[model samples]
Target chain A: MSHDHDHDNELDPFAARVRALETILTQKGLIDPAAIDVIVDTYETKIGPRNGAKVVAKAWVDPDFATWLKRDATAAIGSLGYTGRQGEHMQAVFNAADTHNLVVCTLCSCYPWSVLGLPPVWYKAPPYRSRAVIDPRGVLEEFGLTLPATTKIRVWDSTAELRYLVVPMRPKGTEDWSEERLADLVTRDAMIGTGLARVPA
Target chain B: MNRREANSHAAMLPAGVDAPVFAEPWQATAFAMTVALHDKGLFSWSEWADALSAEVKRPGAASDGHDYYEHWLAALEKLLSAKGVAGKGDVDALAAAWERAAHATPHGKPVLLQNDPSPTEGRGGRIG
Candidate 1:
């Protein structure tokens, strides 16, 4: 007999069952709807990606600070007073002109929300997740990032306790740029090591 | 209790062991926020997604709302920590404050539920 699993990409039976259970809890009023709202809003708004931008900007302007960031990301970040829940221990890597870096939580989704915000659905997709660690260069290529054969590719897998971020090299011709302007060029992917910050004309 | 009664009672409890209408939707919100930040040049979309996807694919991952938020929060923390922008303590303190505020006004007005786009709406072109 053909089982329900034969269906393509549909919600699994277990998932449907869980959805049904959640519906009942919502109707029963055991959990407060407002509380849930608070949780969601807090991450979406009050917390922002500026913190991460600041880090990237600083690294670009100050080489010493960039070295400090890569060496002890947690303590250096703590100095900025941006610590908490999943960000207790952090590490930063620098992707230079000759090297490309990417981060993945192969085991789980560990990210830096205090600075970068929430994750996108594609990040949770299976194709990117499975191929990221196995062939970092291939995944980068799909994203239109081609690293030279000489460029070292480093991939960091996130754990429940430790999280990682990539600090892409500052683009050339930004020597006289202000911190804010430099920050404008720092993208979330640049920090995550998947891509580089684009330069403006 | 009879099997039918047990089944009915099971239905009485919330699905996924978390608030359904409120919780399940946050994942998309989190996804959008991250996407918006990336689009605004705060970070790259690929790296952000890679970090979070790893968490969702973890073994024994909780199929409930709590697991979702916990992982999302963890992802945010990891990203911030990696950039040397924030520390774990900062997040914990904020979470503690949130808990206190939540308890103080159990019946207070809803927050975080406003201005969310519909599921069908485009997520700022980050995801295909």
Candidate 2:
């Protein structure tokens, strides 16, 4: 069946390149296989989207927790036992009716993978990364959000050591919602300071 | 190639290699994050797109995924260098350490991508 053939073609080129680099570095006595194994195991199995979701879920149900998360996200996130590479130091910014927040890793694709999983391609793309910090208001408009002129805007540039998450303002009429239900409203962009969680219909 | 044949052929290449399936799930996740932030009044899409296009047009811009990663690594190095986090010697030492680890491990075992979400692989776990 064509399906079988189609699957083989799906092998990741990025994986292939990483493997090839590993082979070369190993042959040259540059890197140890054990370290690569540790990296692979940690990122592939231990940390991912689930971790990110957990943080969002907790914040939705607990206001104090959410406040703490915004003040010091690394501590709040660590309280849930989701600390590791790419998420060692984290921060959360809150976006509200009077203020807007956005995040960009202007340098490299440094992200809170332990919380958000691997960054999306567009996050790693040249467009969002470079423009986010320069003209955030315009970018926000493209996503279908238009803020009032009186609202203050804050843009964060993520670095290798610290990653930022955006705590989107809770959608209206969700006062009695459960954590899981509220979390469902948290989209990946909402976590990254691009959008707000949507209110359920 | 016929439409189906072309799609089949394109499907055979690794993701991001084929224009059709060019975006990996992780890439989509990042894009969604950007979109979400924009939707929440973080930034406009046009501003972000324009900035990214400018970055692409920069002199000696990368042409492929490999080049892109390399560029990213270089940018990281520059940031570290600026911060005095590590001198050239420190970077060399880390690279040496990574090489040692890579070589010591056994072959045959696959190096899985960080965001491969296949169900058969037991990856379809809790979403959050």
Candidate 3:
């Protein structure tokens, strides 16, 4: 005789509830399910982290844009067509020789979705959310990104509707590099202040 | 939450605000369901307030965002089921079907529910 446990009975209750909700909504003709998928795909791929990278690259090469970004990030980011919903209010924090910037939403997971798209899991997880504020230097170290002891770390807690985008310091020897080339060095973590921008090799 | 607080929760938003940030497709599906239900006037704010609060208390844990949304979905379902918008039994059954669909489908592909409920029967089924 063989006894077996069926996995179908083990669907995570959370997922099950979501699926059930979807079924009920469709049956009531509340929405077209197919359309939601298309929208999800669009945000995940077409309008994602690349938008932030472009902004970072532009700031690295254009001194005027950097000044504009510092003065009025909302308009500067909007001028680039990256303004919407979660990113209606934008603040650009520049990393300097003496300071580094980090962002977190202590209340809820508020991010600049229009520019960075969906946040990575770690960003919303409890450990990163709490530790990023209490012990940012330690959290950065865990990500293998240790900053100099003298560099003051500024943690920005995104609340209500305000969101921030980090402008990483430009790597050395890239004075003549194009904005497009400079953009390649900026990573999501770098913008989030967990890691540093890559140096051109 | 009171009337004012209930209205402010992100889950109660009409629809289409931020980029779709789903830990999984089901999460997106959940959000769409709530938005759709709101558009249809299926439930009331007081009902939403009670259900959501019951499912998720507060943001005690920092990493509880995903779980918080999951509870939000659960609250939505509870409200719909209680209001006879849908039957609880049928919902459970469909959820089970999705689980079977997931088991039958290969990794990296979408797990679509099959007309045949027991799609995982026989043919190795990855049995131990």
Candidate 4:
């Protein structure tokens, strides 16, 4: 669909502005609205954290792949065909018994969209960006996750050139679960280190 | 789109696990426009980042971050202006023209640039 999707009576000013810009660009032959729709469609329904979930799920079951993910995330993720923009460089941070990793972009919302889809609104907001670095443990607590006192919390700041994805530890009872089933437990927040994987009920 | 249609796209995820990347259609449109522009080699991501970082750090920005995409839209416009692809004045005129066209066009009909009440009304539609 074109920018005219804002057919509602109460159109946001930004919506009108964006439509205008698209129309102008289209007139100038600078950009294509169809290409934009394809991109929007891709991010909307095709690429998302579901891709990341599969990566994490495979890592949980395959030690070699997990090692490769640590050794060279871009190549390892590419091996699974999850390669794209904003994820040119990736580093998988594994949550272990004594270490937890959290990601933030202090300057901007530099998320690994190729794997994670678009970053959530809160992820781009000031609170999460600033506090994820300043008060990571408190932030995790606010997310209803309380790590042991001895476990070290490490925060990774993402940039345009490189991004980090947190590989959450598999839930205790999911040892026998299939990769697809394990992926069902990997929420987008889990990959961003804001939440932990869900345990089987 | 309504919440149901928005959430409908997240059918791949289990219950309570999905989050909408964009809160509004305009945000997604703005985002896709930027990516599309970048894909066409209008400007490098680094340049785009510089423009965005400037807007994000603008004085008197909102504290709650509800206006994050507003800044994003501003950055896109600024970047386009800087690249000489479209200037600020041009964007403003085009926006105004679209406002007029949207009002003039009948309901359920696509709002085309030609739908503007006056083709030569703004500096934008000089080609037609």
Candidate 5:
């Protein structure tokens, strides 16, 4: 349902300053930091991975969207109201029965925040960046996502100009489910290619 | 904005851009502070550029363009220190307070801070 759901408050000075600056700016009245905080909180907690989940769900239910996602991800995703910044350029890779897709930004954390919200801290750390390319299977294993031996893994490295979203395969036994219900099954990591969508419960 | 400042920022930022580049709320604040301060005549764009370039070139800093914001923060700190604004001492005191506050804040709650005594307030109190 999420990525590294811990709320560890051991913030760095940079992280703390923005929080401080929020106070500093609120007094200045050029903009309301509180309102911005509401939006940021939504993206961090409520909306974070949910945007990507909706896109995945739509792709599953709408064949046309899936086709478009495969052919032209930028427009298809943008049409869904999930477009901006680091995600200006995008490619959606589907997870097939035999092939699994993974994403990483080795140079820096170029995540689709417009859809995925802020990336987990681990994603930006040195270990994940180096190990993701060196041993993706091991990385997946650490995240507790173990793909079968027959499945092939494809890793996409996100760049400043181009980013990627992973579309996990639809779970079984949910053929009659509503789109909203299906979206609830998509976790942030699923779209990050670190985990699979939830199995029907 | 000064002509030089405007020219530099335009060149640095992408063109025809409709992007939400800030990953977190704080990032947006940090970014806005840069622009707002620049417009307020606190520092010239050229000065900012020099500080940022020096920061990027500083040993042990990541020179890649991905961490541009980190460099942005560094430049802000450098400017703050040199101008006798909120130097490292003031920022550090405030930063430590935030660490404690953030640590105590519950999960799913907004991290808020209260003004506390650490570095004495007012310009030049901590800086000078």
Candidate 6:
């Protein structure tokens, strides 16, 4: 005898609830489901860490933009057109020889979504949230990132009021590299401070 | 999950990859709905944040973060009700309707609101 579970009989409460909510909203003409699809597609394809990468690469090559980013990250990042919810206020923390920056939201997952698209599952996980602050170096080590022993680790706790973007140090041997080339080296993990920018081989 | 299922799951993930961005599709839809509602000017980002933060910080919330999007959906529901959009009772009722609709829906067919066996009064008028 074969034991096959009936999928229809075992409807997930959460999925049902979500579908019900969508249906209700649609019936009320509050939201077009197509619009939701477009937003999802935009985040999946267009708006993401690549936008942050552009900002990082620009900062890498342009000293003035770097200064501007440090002074007013909101305007600096907005000037590049990566502005939206969860990113109303921005601060660019530059990772340097003496200091490394890591971002976490202990209160909640207050990620810079406009620049970073969506926060990774681990970013919102309790272990990373509670441990990133208490053991920043240890968390980095788990991600296979090891900073120099002398480098100080600074953890930024994101809140509803402000979000942080880490400006990782530009890897060596890219002196004459274009901003586009530099952007390619900026990974999502690097912007979030879990890992460093890739060093072109 | 059982050991065999866990191994299959691990096999699916590439090296160094932790987990999928969303464990399920509803999570993505819930996320998109929140953004779409905000785009419709239903609430400010700060207001949305306050609702979500409240849900996330609620006592005894899931520690593994697997239920993070559940909180997210709850926040959206709370915000919608607070804005006088859809009340809690309405959402619960509709969810029950969808549950019926899913069971009523024939296999291999889309589960639509119209498929609800006992479609509640005044809820039948929907756009597509």
- Chain B alone, TM-score of each model? 0.54, 0.38, 0.62, 0.75, 0.67, 0.79
**Docking quality (DockQ) for each candidate:** 0.04, 0.04, 0.16, 0.32, 0.12, 0.34
- lDDT by residue (tens digit), candidate 5, B1-128: 12322232222222212123454445656655655566466676556656655665555643223465676677777786787665565566666667666777666676656423333443212321
Could you give candidate 6's per-residue lDDT for residues B59-122 as a string of tens digits?
A: 7766567789999999999899988988887777778777777888887688877777777533
Clashing pairs in 4: none
Pairs that collide, model 6: none
Q: What TM-score would every model get versus the actual structure?
A: 0.56, 0.58, 0.68, 0.88, 0.60, 0.86
**Of candidates 6 and 3, the better by TM-score:** 6
DockQ sort, best first: 6, 4, 3, 5, 2, 1
**lDDT tens digits by residue: candidate 6, A1-201:** 112555654347888888878987887788898988887778767787889999999999999999999999999999998886643699999999899999999877888888888887668867777888988887787776778899999999998779999999999999999999999999888899988888886
lDDT by residue (B9-40, candidate 2, tens digit) is 12211224113211333222223333333344
Q: Once superposed on the true structure, which residue ranges of model 3 sit more than 4 Å away at CA?
A: A1-12, A27-29, B1-24, B31-128
Model 5 chain B scores worst on lDDT over the 10 consecutive residues at: B9-18
Worst lDDT window (10 residues) for model 2 chain A? A1-10
**Largest TM-score belongs to which candidate?**
4
True contacts kept of 5: 0.20
Off by over 4 Å in 1: A1-35, B1-128
Summarize candidate 1's per-residue lDDT along B87-123 as a digit string, tens digits: 5544343333333333333243442111122212322
DockQ of candidate 2 (2 decimals): 0.04
Worst 10 residues of 4 chain B by lDDT: B8-17
Each prediction's Cα lDDT score? 0.56, 0.55, 0.68, 0.80, 0.67, 0.81
What TM-score does chain A of model 4 get?
A: 0.92
lDDT of 4 by residue, A17-74 (tens): 8987887788789878888888888999999889999999999999999999999999
TM-score of 5: 0.60
Which is the better candidate, 5 or 6, if ranked by DockQ? 6
Interface RMSD of each: 17.5, 12.5, 11.8, 7.0, 12.5, 6.6
Clashing pairs in 5: A85-B19, A85-B20
Residue-by-residue lDDT tens digits, candidate 2, A1-201: 012332222324333323333333344454466555554445545666567766887887788998899888888998988774322478887777888888887765667876876665556656566667877877666555567889888988876567888777788898888887777777766777655666677
